[model samples]
Target chain A: MAATRALGPAPSKTPDKPTDAAGQAPRRRPRAWRWADIAEFAGSAASALLLTWLIFDRFLPFRIQGVAFFVAWYALTLPIYWLVVRDGHGPVAARDRLASVLVTTGAAVALSPIFLVVGYVTYRGWSVIDFGFLAETMELTGPLSGADDGGLLHSLIGTLEQLGIATLIAVPLGVLTAVYLSEISGPLARPTRLVADAMTALPSIVAGLFVYSIVVIRTGWGFSGFAGSLALTILMLPTVTIAAEQVLRVVPGSLREAALALGSPYWRSVLLVVLPTARAGLATAVILGMARVVGETAPVLLTVGGTNILNVNPFSDYQDNIPLFVFNQIRSSKESFVDRAWGGALLLLALVLVLFVLARLAGGAGPGRRSRRKKGAAK
Target chain B: MTTQESEAPVTGQPVGGTLRGVGVSAWFGARKVLEGVDIDMRAGVVTALIGPSGCGKSTFLRILNRMHELVPIATLGGSVLLDGDDIYGTALPITEVRRRIGMVFQKPNPFPAMTIGDNVMAGLRLTGRKTANREQLIEESLRRAGLWNEVRNRLGAPAGGLSGGQQQRLCIARSLAVRPDVLLMDEPCSALDPTSTRRIEETILELKDQLTIVIVTHNMQQAQRVSEHCAFFLAAEDEPGRVVEQGETEHIFGSPEDPRTADYVNGRFG
Candidate 1:
């Protein structure tokens, strides 16, 4: 810590990352025109695609040819494009273009599924998601009910209440664990951190099974919303602790030192300085942990025992939740049930987005926030 | 200065204390930084510790207020007396020791989240010494730090709104609000511009009348200008840092007793 601090505040100017140390005075490379670069890339892609289609589709004996065609096209285009760029520009430009290509392809591959799911779900469900479908309950409806039959209000309420209980139990425990890991140091810190990391990788269904054994089997209790919350808390704790610890770790040692030097005790300094400074990050951690567990179905399936009707009392009886509701709908053979599953999935996505926006707004400003006060005006 | 006849400056009484260290040695894990360093800081005088980088002048400054022990690997040996009582002794709580001896860091670290007024009163509040006259206290501390005229209208604003110079002055005001007996500054102007540096130098000169001050500075000229007494630290090849010479500022600058001190004062070698 001292060695790094000794280096002083991050340098304002990095000298634009000093260019290669070649002794020769390098000539200024002209920037290729934007349209020319685009034209070059498009031409390369088209030629590669045409060649692949002609050679692979026509000449190959295999009936399954889409994957082979894609592979052949990519393999042929990369080297050919590299040579063309190398001729017009330098080796550095060629390398830069190749890296850009790889990154663009990687991003497209990553984003494809998200777009696919959103579009597919909306296409199947948008017509079914009317005011009545969202506001009423599914208690009277059968598995084969038509489009005008059921709603998700009961499930939505159950989800919100179960999450509330889980948050109440897990957030405090996770925050304390994170504080212990990041601030207080002792012999147990290493082992405690290792256990937390191990727990984070523990299967979500195992959390459900563990809670089922304790709350349902051992205590001789029926399936209830509280059981689901307990399982969710177990799943959420490790994630919240890990993320919160990372946030606390970067709260600048100087702030703590400043408060301690003013005669505040260690805990007091942490409360008045460290925690406040990391508030935004802690909010982010809580959001991430909540998001992870909110979409889980296996835990609720084992513990809560899904119901169709609204039950506001989480402790006394079984209750419906969004993921469990969607899971049950999708498993049915009826087309109406599948459309309901899609509607529930879309609603769940919107809920997460809304929750994130609300959390950010509630966080206000972190302790690291600099002065936002405008220049003093004449009175 | 405001001609308001307000009872503000009394909160920052400018009370001074006599500080003496005898054979102080410090270590971070196995690497010793200060080796048996001895110095005296008398009431209402400026004692400067000047050395090149890695010479442990900053380490010694943190030692005075027991801030050095906050680092887990750091260990200290020998006694530092404040008004004839050992600050490192178990008789007094470490918090009280820190309360009596305040520090201004190399960087102006006014808490970015706190308002200007809150930043000023932060030290007093931390020590649980915040009195009923907090409004007056903030005004006086800022005045003592030579920042009143610039920030008096915007006391409720965030401390970070100030320029680099004003922020350092605000930090000084924060330390002064606790009414400490001694003030320790570690290169307070190193991060500031020339104009801000000159203002801080002026604050040091004026503050010398009421506060016993120990400052660690890398700029030899700064040490000569602000400190009445000067201590030179040098780390010989493969040796921990130790004081080479100590005397009045003029004596150290004009005619240093040791050849090494003379060479350093003349800018021959750090």
Candidate 2:
């Protein structure tokens, strides 16, 4: 036994004694109850029940009752963090963890009203999303004209065309201006940055007015998709440029020096290295610019005079866009037209969501390729 | 072999002539950084510039390739003759000069988004050397830098994934892929570990047979170990940076002609 102890046990054998100061078996930690987590769970359940009751119960208007429920739910959950978790009366591990949960739950409850509004719109708008509603133009004179009369196909096509033209004009100009202001050091960059900052705060209506003064009143060109696209471009250029510039500025200086030191021309370096490094952020900026311009009713009203039929040519005649169609229908006193307006709003929201999803997918794909390459390299 | 004997063949060789700077001075908007500096770099050899921080060793290296002109306010007086032609002549394009003389920064700055292969080929592509087989060149360059086996399978991976030592070797590979006649490295091994430093020192020894290399370093032992010739830069009484002495590395370390060089090499004062 002494020889065995001196040599230690065989490698495959397990130790028989406990390895602790007390020389007894190790004690398992007791799981503690986190009150703040339980409170958040209870609060979410209460909010869901109240929302369900408000929507299904015949005694209350969903709009008013739903909003009130969310308000109360948020108010109740907001203080749980301060009262229970922040006071640290609970177990140490539970305190910090539950505090985060309560705070997040409070924020979610506060934003619940916006979710309710979107749900209501989507629910009411689903009925008009069939093939007939999508394939026909709104040139008919009557309500619920099934398959042969009215559809949003024309407006959809026109909206895409107008936005495309607007992006074509805006993206290049915006990116170049941003690059100049941020990268090139000169006496003019300061003043140009100031102008860009000022332009960021310019009102959308003011942009429309500026475009109207230049392309409409001065040039004697009547309202058309081309003019509207020009107006939207004016509104969106500053936004995209500012966002792109900020993203580009955040790219580490080492990357730039690496490319330049490799004998790459400055412009080539910007094109191949700098641009691809910030491609995700740039894509997000472009999508944001698209979202800003796609729903501008004021500019479309002032520039692209609403037409009942689709006009494929953006430069020549008035064109129909979803937002303009919705605005025109909403102003009419017909209930059927109002329903169409709601449906159009839903479609526009869906379009923006799709763009957002595309931006996210593209961003996801770039980094995925990088990580996959890393894994392959590791092996 | 003696220090003078080892340097004799390099100084006298006529294949690719030596680079010589005479009465060289650099100024940045009326601030003088280097004053009346004169040095000669023997062809196809490693010349180490050893100095304290802010002694303008890096600035002097940049001047060799006309890289200082990248700064809009930077101006230089005097001539840098490369293979008998004046590099500062108005007729020579700055881009062409940089292509023939590549530089690596103090920090290893491989393009973060680019693949290792792409980073190595960056210089060749920029100079429009399209006929060069990219894969072969990449493998050759990485092998020369002693990084081939480590990164061979992951040629498509981002260069930023490498550790600091690997990144520095990648930077050296990038400079080598351009096939420049001269390579300027600014404190290449300062940010690396001992093993990495030893590997780089080996790579430098292997490279000096083919291309002339000028390196700036703060470590005196590294300078003594790797360089065939060494230049000592120090701050003057009133001026900031001037070359005190430059000769064979062994002579400069063993028995220097100047007192300042002896003091610095002996660790008396910087």
- Predicted model with the maximum TM-score: 1
Q: Residue-wise lDDT of candidate 2 within A189-232, one digit each (tens)?
A: 88878887798777778877877888977898877888888989
Fill in the DockQ of model 1.
0.38
Per-residue lDDT, model 1, residue A370, is 37
lDDT of 1 by residue, B19-79 (tens): 9998999999999989999999999999999978888899999999999998899998988
**TM-score for candidate 2, residues paired by index:** 0.80
lDDT of 2 at B105: 82
In candidate 1, what are the lDDT values of residues A217-302, reduced to their tens digit? Answer: 79988788999999999999999999999999998788788887777778877876788678778988898889878998999998
Candidate 1 pairs with clashing backbones: none
Residue-level lDDT tens digits of model 2 in B23-93: 88888889888888888887888899998777889889989887777777899888888877788887656
RMSD to the hidden true structure, all candidates: 7.8, 9.1
